[model samples]
Target: METDLLIIGGGPAGLHAALTADRAGARVVVADESFSLGGQLRQQTQWLSNLPGQYGYGKKRGTWVNEQLINQVGASNVQVLKKHTMIGSYLNGNIGVSDGDKTFEIQSRKNIIAPGAQEEAKVFPGWTLPGVMTAGAAQILINREKVLPGKRAVMVGSNDFSLEVARQLNSCGITVEAIVEEKNQIICSDGELVKTLENVPVYTNSTIEIVTGAGEVEHVVIQTPDGLKEVNVDLVCIANGFSPILEPFEIMNCHFVYQKELGGWLAAYNIHLQTTNPSCYIAGNAAGITDFGSILLTGEIAALSALEAMGFISSAEGTEQKSRCWRELANLESEKVLQARTEMLADYHQKHELDLPDYFMKIKGGKMYG
Candidate 1:
């Protein structure tokens, strides 16, 4: 298949990119591995608060937004390829995609990578146990599949995700024994989150050293400044962090920059979202782990840039649209920083380093060795 613009992802970024390019009258194709197209929003419990002093939307709202975007793209000439995964990309605009037993090749005038990020699970001694899972995976199972992994769970992490998962589990009648943060700091301080923490025990400066059970997680051993302690729990949720899925970009030899704050290595792109390779662009978490609103704005900007590059639209039109989108994105990012700072400082009285075992260190160094 040949297309004017080939977008290798169906998440918010890829969807928005298709919409933007299609609206500009460019031939677009979008592919994603999942059966659905909402990306991580399908598992997320609530919408991220991008603007301060505003009530954040929930998963349902996110679903509605995703559906609306998909509808718009589908209404246009954009080709939606759900359950199709782009396995590799090559120079000269050649791409390899797979769907079940079939593989297909596509040539495009331009490509946009938006494969997004994946949850990082560092291997601990008993990490392979049935009840162990990443925070995102657990949410996917419980919120999406409506399957409870366990009756009692112990969550380990000190981030907004950890707090949110704890609240969700408790609200669903699952006994969350405690939320353990290797760091003694509180990473989220939204009024709603704080209210949830009032009931769940928050353990600071602690690490889950070992999880032991016959076939599943039954007890979790934690190490804290005080001493070693054991908590009886049936499930353990690890909220380590996220790493970008850059395999497709690597295959295309796209230049990337390592940004610790943005969840590791990200494609190097200009203000227009054009990568080192002019024929390619990247946006959303695939570009870097920015907030959702920023992802949407980046998608729009990247699409306009791609359209201009392909001569489907004039530079003046692309520039005008990009500037407008960027202005809103910048404001949203600024507010996100303020909110993150406020949340970080709320538990300033207790701050410590992240507790990661040596094995996890090996895993991080292995896949994301960059």
Candidate 2:
């Protein structure tokens, strides 16, 4: 297939990008691996407020916003290719994609790659057992699939993600027996939300020594500050941090850098979300890890950057949209992430100007020498 612009990943970033580009009269095509759009937003039951555009304070749920985007895109002229996965990427700008039946290549004038992030797992003994899964998996089961993960659950982290999932599980009538935190205090900054988990006992400075079960998760032994405590639960939710899915960028030969704060290795890009390959832009968690609000803004910025580069939009127009998105993103993102991004962009630009060394050869897993 051939198009003016191709967006990979129908998540928030790619959906927003498709809408932005389509509005600018670009023939846009969005290919996603999922049957439905919205990516992680589909499983998010959180209330999203204070977003930059089309959302007001206490107005929209995450799924509602996702639906709005989907509906808007559906009403537009852009083409949607669901259940399509990118299998190969070439330096010449041709992308090989598969729809489970056959492989095909797509050629586009410009591309926006926003394959999103993957949930990180901290494995322990018996983690491979049934009913033991990542927090995201549990969320999909309850929120999207409309199925209960377990009647009794134990959340294995105290971060915001863990707490939010715990809250959701509790709301679904699943008894969150305990929240085990290796840190001395709760890591979630939302005081009000943390209060929801107050009734659910929190074991600070605790680690899961083992999870025992016959065929499913039956009990978990946590090494607390005092001693080993056993909690009986059917489900074990591992709510660790997330890591950017870099396979898309890696296949495209995009430069990568390690930024621990941004969720490990991510594509090196500029303020405009343009990677080392000028034709290819990245957004959302594929660029760096941030909240949903910031991810939306980054998608707009990336599309604007691509539109300007393709001469579909004026420089002034692109700059105006980007400035507005950046302003909103600044408010939604953390100071640490913003600072780290500044450093990462500076490094990317500096290296982009220099010649690559001989050691920069193709490595396994599609990751080249950095």
Candidate 3:
């Protein structure tokens, strides 16, 4: 398949980018691992806010927004290839993708990679148990497959995402015995704290010492200041946090820095979202962890940036979009789970000798070795 643009991940970022580029009269090809599109949007179950100018501000369920994007993709000149996994880098401006039985060579002038994120599984004793899984897996079971993970569950993590997953599990009629966190106290607002407290008790200053089970998870041991508490649970959802899908960026040889707030290692993109390789651009959470609105706007802005780089869109038009997108991005970073630690970012600028914008100067983690 030959096209002007090839979006390597059909989630929120990829789909949004594909739609915008196609609307600009560029032929787009969107490939995803799932049978349909929408990436992590499929796992979400809340209302989105503070979107870009094109999206506007609206309160809509994750399902609704995801469906809407799929419809938009269908209506545009974007070709959707479901169940296709990108196997290799864009060598000579072309990429190799496989759909189970066959491999296809897609040649494109530009590429937008939005592979999304995956939950990080913290290694502990018995974490490899059958019933031990990431919160995302449980989300897929309940949100997508409509299957309850287990009758009794010991949820780990106390962030907004983990709490939301607990609520989703409760909605599915599963018994969430307890919500555990490594921190001493919940970090959410009082209102959210009150609501969650009413449903499940939060065991703060605790960590899952070990997950013990025979063939599956039978119980979990929580290490606390006082002592160890054993909770009998059939399933354990390790919702510690997520990490960006960085394999593709690494394969493309992009320079990276470990930003814990952004969910570990992320590609270093300029204000224009272009990576170290001028031909490649990073978008969405893959750039760093932000809100849903940031994801949409970043994806759209990336499309514009790529278009301008390819001479399909004007630099002036792209600049206007960038200004708006940056505001939304700032709003997201300033008020979300982990705000940017501006001081920690001095290393990147000093070392790389690049004049990065404030939006790209967020560094909230430690140094990563390979």
- Clashes per prediction? 0, 0, 0
- Candidate No. with top lDDT: 2
Given candidate 2, what's the lDDT at residue 118? 95
Residue pairs clashing, model 3: none
Please provide, for model 3 over 241-298, each residue's C-alpha lDDT reduced to its tens digit, 9 standing for 90 to 100.
7777888777777788776777777887666777776767888888777777778877
> lDDT per residue, candidate 1, 1-370, as tens digits?
9899999888888888898898878989998898988788766656566621122443335655666776777678989888998887644558889998898888889888888898888676799998999888778888899998789988888577777887778777789888788776766656677676687777789877899999989988888788887889898998887777788877887776666666777666666676767778888887666677878877887899889888989977776677666555655664443233223222221232333222222222112221
Instruction: Output the number of the TM-score-best candidate.
Output: 2
lDDT of 1 at 301: 77
TM-scores, all models, native as reference: 0.86, 0.93, 0.90
- What's model 3's lDDT at 247? 84
The digit string of per-residue lDDT tens for model 2 on 97-193 reads 9999999989999899999999988889999999999999999999999999999999989888899999999999999999999999999988888
Model 2 segments more than 4 A misplaced: 353-370
Clashes of 2: 0
**Best-to-worst ranking by TM-score:** 2, 3, 1
lDDT per model, in order?
Answer: 0.74, 0.86, 0.77
Cα displacement (angstroms), candidate 3, residue 72, comes to: 0.8
